[model samples]
Target: MVAVGAMGVAPAAEPNTQVPAGSRHYAASDFPDRIVASPAQDAATGFAVAWRTSTLSAPPLLELALAGDSPDMGRLRQITANSRILQSENGTSQHHRADIDGLQPDTLYAYRVQGQGTWSAWNHFRTAGAAGQPLTLLYFGDTQNKNLSHVSRVIRQGWQTAPDARLALFAGDLVSGGDGMDDSEWGEWFAAGGWLLPGMAVAPAAGNHEYFEEFEDTPQERRVLGGHWPVSFALPGNGAVATANTTYWFDYQGVRVAVLDGTSALDLGTAQAQAQWLDGVLADNQQPWSIVVVHQPLYPLRAERDTSVLATQIRPVLQRHHVDLVLQGHDHTYGRRADDNAALPQYISSVAGPKQYRLSPQARATMEPVAEDTQLFQVLHIDGKQLRYEARTATGRLYDAFQISRDGKGRKQFTELREGRIAPRDCPRPVSPKGRDDRCWE
Candidate 1:
């Protein structure tokens, strides 16, 4: 284990061991629940927010104002939100969304949502600052299983590491059940992030688990975006027409994050469309840094998992655009591959839930610092021409560190910071079907 002081990492905090409450505890009510603030296409001057409620008798409303030392009711501006009714296993509910725009850059604002006649407490968020300004972001992999019980603490620790992160990016598989029928899973996911979900702008890519298809309906497996997705997030609806909000991009400061729906692209035969869309988005990107977040990795880290189709379609577009990094999830393990060719983007696949998987032979041979049975979160800070990235275990121990610096000619130099890092925790024995390996510890 690395020394906390030497690594400049805070000691691991006590894990939250309390069992999550029942689904009824998180059921929709007259008051707003599952409120989330998301990034707009141009996050510097605009943002979007969404929430769920039990009833829709009255139109949903949102109030926003610049945050101040004291709350002044008179300064609040009222905006009516658009609502959509959704039927799920839990029950019928209404999801409301409002896109707030015309705001000052790098400004802080307080906002709240309305449910029927009730109102949610005030939550605040800051817009993106000017380009070239320092930026920090928190990235997480799948929180698919045991979300509240095991993944909650990891999410909290990420917030602790970068409390002022401009965005919290999830590679995906946010819940175990992809159909959106299991509202309890969504509840656990929301509870895992707690207040942090609404405090920072969230950008998530849709994983395989976020899509569901009925075999009886089609001879070929055709996945459909779950009902809960659009209702749960008010993302920038500017992607391939078929994927729309599920596949989008947003610019925060100097970074352009292009989120893709790899599940839909691979299973639903939308790969060509998304590839073309990605090429255009990247071609038009003006940010100094470019990142692609997708649930399925171009390089699969798990044994026997096939990603050749996904890789073939998307990899060329990414390379052509010179994307700096590609963050992925779904293998339920941690594996990173820095290509020998610096022109290729750095590829990383990680997991944040209790679930685990065995590494592929290729991963064991080519990827460095691979791990299993360990939940991790990443904190990335970009200042000027350099980007510093650190991967930390759920216990807050620094596991891997690296820095990427770009030159005036747009060439990148990768530097590994291995001092004070803990040894990789790969399982000696293969992980069991239930994600168990006697030698691997949580």
Candidate 2:
């Protein structure tokens, strides 16, 4: 077991026994780890590559080529990456980033990173096609499991369901152990994704767990942005400066995906700025379908939770723009709700880990079908004016499914795609206040 700070750096230790094969540890290395591709200015014509190298390694460079039908990767185009030094429990390392523009839309490309003589395995990614093209995306919420393998299984199952999903959207709480700064946990996360990463773009929203600060009396136990949030993945920089790395938006085909930092907006006093920016983005969005991914659900599943501030600050913007879907994760339960006042965008929350939380009556009343103590994944398909959504258990059990269609008049009609097959699962009420019992008693 590895001991890490609540946030930020932990005391230096030996390489974690948990590090999986093919994943990079935090220690200095000639090869890169956490190699990923993120949306740049435009999904079709621009993309950014980011990775990490050990402090012992030199600045890295990216080699890219248009993947062709033949196995031979033709001529390589080289791009110099900018390096930033970062310190973690594994010691110091360099984070490298490079943004490429003017790539052909809907084209396949292969890329690899090299620091010193060691190079990363080549990864291939397909660019988004023109607007109105059909697309599939996978969404997961709060995958902070006690053991990363539990979350890994869910992710692999999701890809098995939609192997060609263009993008994976994470609604925060990616890893709660050590506030995401734990290098070993990140290695597990990267290893779990396996080849999917770098091959497919990742869009992550920052959850409360992603934020931490040093205590006035305990500087060594500093907590801040987890050790990896800003460095592990290179997300789009088109967000409010105050919430730069976590807040961003990108378009794939005709769908517009906006990632908001719910924790920062609520705790750091950046709500107004984010709200204003969100309004502007949604107001001007011309995309046929829009989706918002945030850490905390506006309509929380827990009774003790109150997201009125978030609703007041952000919900109006979503309603005004007629967003198609709002995906959230935080409450460790599965739920979907359609606002009575507004119905264009359905609000949903899901957990893809072993963690489970009791769903409140208020949450149960809004959702037609909900689940507890079940790891789940959501697959979304968008084609023309129609959007399809399906929620399934980690092992591939269909739970809830629905479809939304926009008519010529811009009116939206929804249909329950699955009727009798839906099996709603909820844990039994705890017999005692301790809440340690995992079973129900008659």
Q: Rate the local accuracy (lDDT) of all candidates.
A: 0.85, 0.79
Pairs in clash, predicted candidate 2: 28-54, 29-54, 212-223, 213-223
Model 1 pairs in collision: none
Q: What is candidate 2's CA lDDT for residue 12?
A: 35
Q: Any runs in candidate 1 off by more than 4 Å, and if so which?
A: 1-23, 178-181, 216-221, 428-442
Residue 12, candidate 1: C-alpha displacement in angstroms: 23
- Model 1: per-residue Cα lDDT over 342-408, one tens digit each: 6348899989987777777888998888998789999999966999889999989999888999898
